[model samples]
Target: MIINKILNVDDYYYDVFMAISGTLTGFSANELQSTGLAETYYKHILGQIETATFLEFLNVSKSILENSFSQDQLRNAIQSEIMADPGMQDMSNNIITMWYLGTWEGTYVNELSYKESLVWNVMHAHPPGAKQPGFKSWAVQPVNSNS
Candidate 1:
């Protein structure tokens, strides 16, 4: 007889969230953790959505991450499994927006998240007025300014 394994989302909900966020945002888990806002984002998401629905989303995300082997496969799995569901779409979009823009539901999550937002890095700039680059550092060119 074969025993089916149960998906224990509560055992690894945050891990699943990070993996899903990385996949959704095209960033790695390490990058997301480096922001120091993973816990904040996780709690925010939990507070925004219902417990049962959040657990279900975590379970689906866990399955997709497990079954996907390559980036292409991951994208396909996400498109079919997560993006296909209206509820999951909202959660996924929020996760992507939070990672890239440091906001959720069109509002800034916090000052920390805004400071460490990924969109600035993607655009090869820092968040305006967040990180001062020293006195007159703009005289020369930025170190990573070259495309």
Candidate 2:
């Protein structure tokens, strides 16, 4: 049950998390796995959040995504789930933030933490001000880097 220990979900629901999170954040499941979301966020940050809210968020999110296909359907299911439980919006946002930013504030309701963000990896681009490789070198194609 190490997978459950790590992801806080049964083995079967692992794919559910992958699908919902990937569709919601527009990242591939492989991309998420590459960044170690289960170890960093699920076991650490999510484990520290309000247990009921976090668990409910997972349960409801999985339920919503179960019978859905396409990005739009996934979005709708998440929206419906959020409507059913307003607090889950915060949970959903935090999850997305965790994937893209690689850190969670435990419901502080603030901007995402991009210090160790996976977005930089997903985008195959630099974070502009953070830590750009070979500064002003113009070697890598700048997605948002200003000259």
What lDDT score belongs to each candidate, Candidate 1 first? 0.80, 0.62
TM per candidate comes to 0.84, 0.66
Residue-level lDDT tens digits of model 1 in 1-147: 111222233546777777777778888777888898988898898898798898898888888777777778878988898889998898888889999999989888988988999997788777778886578777968666684
Q: Which stretches of candidate 1 lie over 4 Å from their true place?
A: 1-11, 142-147
Supply the TM-score for candidate 1.
0.84
Q: What overall lDDT, based on C-alpha atoms, would model 2 receive against the true structure?
A: 0.62
Worst 10 residues of 2 by lDDT: 1-10
lDDT of 2 by residue, 85-144 (tens): 668777777778777766666442223335446778767766677666675666655667
Question: Could you tell me the lDDT of residue 146 within candidate 2?
Answer: 82
Please give the distance, in angstroms, between residue 5's alpha carbon in candidate 2 and its true position after superposition.
14
Question: lDDT score, residue 4, model 2?
Answer: 22
- Give per-residue lDDT, candidate 1, residue 72: 86
